[model samples]
Target: MKVLAAMSGGVDSAVAAARAVAAGHDVTGIHLALSRNPKSYRTGARGCCTIEDSNDARRAADVIGIPFYVWDLSDAFHEEVVEDFMAEYAAGRTPNPCLRCNEKIKFAAVLDRGMALGFDAVATGHYAQLRTGDDGMIEMHRALDHAKDQSYVLGVLTQEQLAHSLFPLGDTTKDVVRREAADRGLLVADKPDSHDICFIADGDNAGWLREKLGDRNPNTGGDIVDSATGEVLGHHEGTVGFTIGQRRGLRLGVPAPDGKPRFVLDIEPVSGTVSVGPRAGLQIDRITGIRPRWCGTVPEVLDGPAVTVQLRAHGAEHRAVVAVRPAGASSEGAPMGVASDGSGSGSVEIELLEPAEGIAPGQAAVIYDGSRVVGSATISGTGRSHALAQTLQRVAT
Candidate 1:
């Protein structure tokens, strides 16, 4: 089989390509030049767009005895990933750019182009497994090393992509991948993995957005009201700057009467006010996910027993009961009275055993059943209504 391997100048991809070659597959390495200006990468940062990274990929390809090339996808990346990231934040939604990049650039654009150029499949350094089902359908499974699993970030992949996708390092731990690269005389063997978001090189996403979008005046400060009473207790620059369950940076001079620190209970971007309350106020029983997508065909209903739902990659999968919501009942805007079954519009509600915190709108909520990834959806909004108080009382008893 002819495979096109994505080498990011990282040890994981280096070992992955070597493993593919050892498996009797013809593999070639390609480093994506996602950034037009590679020199913009910081001195210490090992971002994907750096000249050093491209050189590392070429060297690794040479060590593995494979043809190597650099493909520039900067235009598509800027359009689909970077621009969308800034726009989502400007619209008061925290977007996951990594997930978007996987969906648009890695899977859609790169995979299509590679296949057109006569490559049978596209391989990557992702720590997720792909298996073929009895009916010839490709199924995506969790990586063997749960701590280093990257299935959540690749949740947006389509079933067709999974059929031709290769993840050689899925079953191997990070340490093992690094050791394999070292054994093969690869230079990035002991290099630390890059953890920052690739495009934002630095972690200043908000600052990057501000530079892209015109400098909108910092809106006047407003009261950080209590979620229960609408009573103004403190002032804040704007609610948009805050997320749902943020604990610190609430500049409220007075401590919560109970001695515990105040947590951001809610952020009302419309009123430009944030609501501060005790930590208990952030707990929620249920969450709604929108724009749902699954590797397999959508189920008629997701009700069987308790399943696992992941709000973010590298986070615990919470045990939850899944239900298909009527297409447009919850806010975040959809046509009302639409399909109640999961087949039509693909909206869902994963009712957790307890409330999960740090869940923000526009993030993905991926569901899993055992080791297999079931599906995922965007968090259109949250359900922090008056009913939460009654739910909390029930939990307390």
Candidate 2:
């Protein structure tokens, strides 16, 4: 097999590429140069594809004795991942940029280019397992190291992408992978794993967004209103500075009547309103998802054993019953009619058996049947449990 190994200058990817070579595959390594100005992104061990990272990848490739090259994906990455991140945040929604990068840049752009060059598959360091099911379709599953599993981010991949993808480190733990890297003489063996958004040089997301958005920012300042009282408790520099679950750094001048800490319940970008309330208001039992992407066969409905949905990249899974239908379909057994926001994409309605908290729109909801990924969808809306809604209503009255 001709494998195109994506070496990210990290221990996992270096070991993955090495393992691919040891398996007798004709492996060629490549590092994605995602930023046009490499210095603008994170440097040192905190970065993923910085200039230093590219050099590290090259060295790792040399150690593995494989042909290596750097692909300039800056333009594609900027339009797809970076722009999309700002746009999602501007619309008052929280998005996972890593998921977007995997969907648009890694699998879509890189895979297409690799196949054009006659490569059979593109392997990465992602900790997610792939297997052929009874139907002979490629099925993605959780990695052996549950703590390091990254299947949630890779959930956006389609059946075709999964077919041409290889994840060699999926069955191994992080410690073992690092040990293998050291044994194989890869220097990145001890490099700390990159955290936070790669493109953001500093971890301050709000400041970065404010500077990048500039004139396009909807509101320079807005009121942080209490949901229960509709009273303006404080003001914010921007609605993008807050997210659904945020409880700290609110700088609210007024305390809640109940004296309980308030969590951001909602963000209305157009109205410049950030609603705060008791944590109970954050509980939601239903999620409406758009742009459903299936890993293999698309099921009409998923229920019973192993049916679950993960809302965040590393968040716990919620046992759920999911129903798939065309966008704008009737709300039958689901909580609401799934709308595609005029994109005409398919929709997924997920009913969590147990309620989830602080679920925000624009986040990916990856559905699974036990270890195998069924599909994923972008969350568009959420609904509180009826009982909870009634309780809140009573409290309000």
Identify the leading candidate in terms of TM-score: 2
Which 10 consecutive positions of candidate 1 have the poorest summed lDDT?
335-344
Model 1 over residues 205-284: C-alpha lDDT tens digits?
54555555555523335679877677777887554456667786777777666687777776655567778777776676
Model 2 segments more than 4 A misplaced: 328-344, 391-397
Clashes of 1: 1
**RMSDs, each prediction?**
4.5, 3.7
Model 2 RMSD, rounded to 1 decimal: 3.7
Per-model TM against the reference: 0.88, 0.94
- Candidate 2: the clashing residue pairs are none
How many residue pairs of model 2 clash at the backbone? 0
